[model samples]
Target: MTRPWEILTAATVAGSGLLAGVFFAFSAFVMSGLRRLPEQDGSAAMRSLNVTAQRPPLMIALFGVSVLCVVVIVRAIAGWPRPGAVWLLAGAIVTLVGAVGVTAAINVPLNNRLDAGTVLWSQFLAAWEPANHARTILCLLGCALLSVGTIRWH
Candidate 1:
């Protein structure tokens, strides 16, 4: 009895969860460990990390998942009688804006500044970590919502 919307909603839940785990790793361990490194090493590491993170595969996941979230929202709305449609829509929008959008709008610009030597370590962390944390929470929230929605009426 699994329908197209069911499959798509399940995929959205998985995608959101996977991406959230990545961000959670950064906020929880990677950045803190980077802070413990020597100033020069830390700065160099961050720069390198940012560059490497933009690899095609990772970029695809980061962006592709966001796009899928939008598709899920659209589908959810179009077939409004689906039990968890509203939750799916809310989760998609939240993840799109709070996680993907924040990363693109805020974190990317801050990374650019760090790349250009316009900001120092303390400045970089202060600005970057908070936004990263926010995205992590949002992604996790979205994942939870989607998970619940996926199972609620299935």
Candidate 2:
């Protein structure tokens, strides 16, 4: 048997990398898209960029958190006796549950409830500022901790 914790640690590192690539990478993509939106005509590019801004980050956070949970669960299953993992796992849980889960449960539904089309994006940004910021900070911190764990080993 490969043993569960080892599998989990490997998976978490890989999953974190993938999440970083997809979500954190979009910060630049979104910035570029925002920068170009004014110069470029209103077109598919705007829509694509807006969708990316609205989504991939959240999706990535959710995926990363879910994987973190999996890592812990695998540890439990494999009977890995390391106690230090609890810190990294707990940090991941707080960030994921508090940041990603709450945003999806609350803010997203609010966005969906609004009448379709003709939304003031500025207004949306303003309304979501606090929540969005919270999610961003928490997830980034969690990712950092996971990175440390990846390097440190138990």
Candidate 3:
């Protein structure tokens, strides 16, 4: 029978992977597609996306994974010296600080500025795309770490 920690580990891996894919889409094509549009159209479309992104599905995925990361950190600390503990802890921290932290600190503010018309599309794209790329890398890294940890778990 599977334990609670096993379930949590699996969920965290899945959540990080899901977030990685989402960010990858943005980094790979969404931002590029927006950039290809006329400035006003791109800005307006991005503003609409910013508003739409605040809805439940993404909010849950993002914030929920953050919460899960916290729990995983605690578990990793408690289970220190265990085979997978270090990897798990590293994964949780990287995802929390690298992915979610960057989103909260950099991306969201840029999105807000664009939505509020305080920033132009070109300016927003210049900053937001780079940050999105960073978060994408972090999410993929976290997912990889978590997968390794899960595999090492006995």
Best by lDDT: 3
Model 1's alpha-carbon lDDT is 0.85
1-154 per-residue lDDT for model 3 (tens digits):
1598889999999999899999999989998998899999989888888888889999999999989999989988887877888998999888887667999999999988887789877889989999999999998899899888888767
How close is every model to the real structure, measured as TM-score? 0.93, 0.57, 0.96
Candidate numbers, best TM-score first, in rank order: 3, 1, 2
lDDT of each: 0.85, 0.52, 0.88
- Per-residue lDDT over 100-137 for candidate 2, one digit per residue giving the tens place of the 0 to 100 score: 57568755654553324444555544454455545555
Sliding window of 10 residues with minimal summed lDDT for model 3: 1-10
Q: Residue 41 in candidate 1 has what lDDT? A: 92
Q: What is the RMSD, in Å, between candidate 1 and the native fold over all Cα?
A: 1.4
Per-residue lDDT tens digits for candidate 1, residues 90-136, read 88887787667999899999999999999998999999999999999
Candidates 2 and 3 compared: the better one by TM-score is 3
Candidates arranged by lDDT, highest first: 3, 1, 2
lDDT of model 2, residue 64 = 59
> Candidate 1: minimum summed lDDT over ten consecutive residues — where?
1-10
